[model samples]
Target: MKLEHVSKTIRHKVLFDDISFQIHKGLYRLTGKNGSGKSTLIRLLSGLSAFDNEKRLKLEGDVLFLDLNPIGLAPFSIKDNFYLLCKTYQVKLTPELEANVEAFFSDSYNDDYLHASVGTKLKLGLSLLLVKEWDYIFIDETLSTIDNDSLKIVAKQLVKLSKTSTIIYVFHNLSCLLLEQNSRILHIEGGKVREV
Candidate 1:
C-alpha cells in the first residue's frame, strides 16, 4: 500500500503530519519507541480506526489487519479459527485448504500440531496471512511470544506470502524480522514515522 500525506490528530494533539511513503509489495518492519504511535498507525491503515481530519489515508489495494490480542474465544481451536476466517472472507475452505492449515500451523512450530504452546496460538494468527491471500497484511507487534526457529519459519512464510502481497509488520525486535535484508524498516517516534 502507498500512503501520501497521511497524518492523524486528536483534539489539540498532532500525531503525525505530511507522512508520505511508498511501500512495495514486500515485508516492512515498523519499529519505534514506546507510545510512538505504532499501534495508532496500524489501526489507521487497517481500517480498524479512522484518521483525524488533518490526515489523508489511502490504500492502493486490499488490506487486512490482524488484531494484537491472542486470546481467542472458547471452543475455537486453530482449525476452527482458520475456518471462520476463511468463511468470513467469503472464500471456500476446501480439503486442500484444510491441509494447508494443518501444515502451516504444525510446520511453524516443531510440534506435531498447533496445540503446543501459547506461541503456537500466535503462529495460528500469523498463518492467517497465508490462508486468506490479502493484498496487504498488517501485524501489530504480535510476534512477541514467537521464538527463533518459529520466527524463521514465519518469516519465510511471510516472504512467500508477499510474493503477490504486501506486509506491514510492527516488531520490537528489528533484527529478528529483518532476516531478509530486502525488507524495509520504518521507525515511529514522537507520533511520526521516519525511515531509519
Candidate 2:
C-alpha cells in the first residue's frame, strides 16, 4: 500500500507534510522520537484518519489498532467483555476462541475484567487478533508496559499474524523483539517517513 502526497495537520501545525511511502505485506516496526508523527502516520496508513490528498488516498484495509488499553468495560465480566468484543468484530464465537479466552482469563472469566491486571487484560484482547482476519494491524506502543511473559506471547502471536496481514508495531524506541523478529523498520522524523 502507498500513501502518496499525504499531509496531516492538527491545530494549524503540520505533523506530516505531503509524505509518501509504499510498504508490502509483512511486519513493520515504526520508530520515531517522542512528539514525532509516528502514531499520526500509522492512523493515516490504517485508513482511520483522513489526510490532505495531493493524490487520491491509497491505503485501504480492515484495520485492528491496539493502543495499550483495549475495549473492555470496567464493570463487565471478562466473559461478557470478550463476547462483546467478538460481537463487535463479527467473529463467530467458537470452541477454540472460548478456550483461548479461558486461558487468558484463567480462573477469573466471571470476574470483572478490569479487576485483573493490565497485562492480563491486554493478553485477552491480543488473543482475538489470532482468531480474526484483517488486512492491517497497527499496534501503537501496546506492548511497552506489559510484563515480559505477556510481551513474549503477544510478540509470537504478532509474528504469526504477520504472515497474512500487514502488521505495523509503532513505538518511539527500538525493541529487541522487533530486531530479532522478521520485521522491517520505518522511521519518521521532521515530518517525513522513510525506511531505515
Candidate 3:
C-alpha cells in the first residue's frame, strides 16, 4: 500500500503535510512525540478517516483497525460478543474456535465484558481480532493498558500475526516490547515521516 502527497489539517493547524510512504508485509512501529500526527496518519491509512488527497492513496487487501478503547464490545457477554464479531466478519464460528476463545479469557468467558477491567477487555477484543483474517492490521495504543504477562502474550500473538499480515503499531513509549527483527520503525515529526 502507498500514500502519496497525503496531508491532514485539523482546525487551523496542519498535522501532517504531503507525506508519502509505502507499507509492506511485516511489523512496523510508529512513534512520535505528542501531537505529531502519528494517530492521525494511522487513521488515514486504515480508512477510518479520509484525507485531502484521498484518490492518491493506494491500498490493497483487507485492512483492520483496533483502537485502544473499542466500542460495541460492551452491553454483551464475552461469548455473545465473540459470536457477534464472527458473524459481522462472516467467519464461521466453529466449536474449536469458541473453545479457544474461552481458553484465552479463561474464567471471564461468561462474564460481562463491559464490566471487566480495561486490560481484560483489551485482551478479549485482541484475541478475537487475532483469529480473523486481514492483510493489514493497525493497532493504536491498544496494548498500553495491559499487564506485563498479558503484554507478553499479546506480543507473541503480534509476532505470529506479522508472518502473514502487515502490522502497524502506534506507541508513545519504545520499551513496551521488543519488536521483530524485520520490523521497521517510523518516526513522525513536524508533519513528516522518516525511518529511524
Pairs of colliding residues, candidate 1: none
Q: Please write out the lDDT profile of model 2 over residues 54-80, one tens digit for every residue.
A: 333444656787877666887887788
Query: lDDT tens string, model 1, 89-115?
Result: 776666776776676666543342335
lDDT of 3 by residue, 1-196 (tens): 7877878888879888888888777789898888888888888878778887554344677677787875447689877777787777777667777776777777887889778777777776677554666788888988787677666666777777788888898866544445545468888988898877
**Strongest candidate by TM-score:** 3
**What TM-score would candidate 2 get against the native?**
0.86
Q: What is the C-alpha lDDT of each candidate?
A: 0.68, 0.75, 0.75
| Estimated TM-score for each candidate | 0.78, 0.86, 0.87
TM-score of 1: 0.78
Clashes of 2: 0
Distance from true position, residue 35, model 1, in Å?
Answer: 1.6
Q: Report how far off residue 94 is in candidate 3 (Å).
A: 3.7
Cα-based RMSD of candidate 3:
2.2
| Model 1: residue 3 alpha-carbon error in angstroms | 3.3
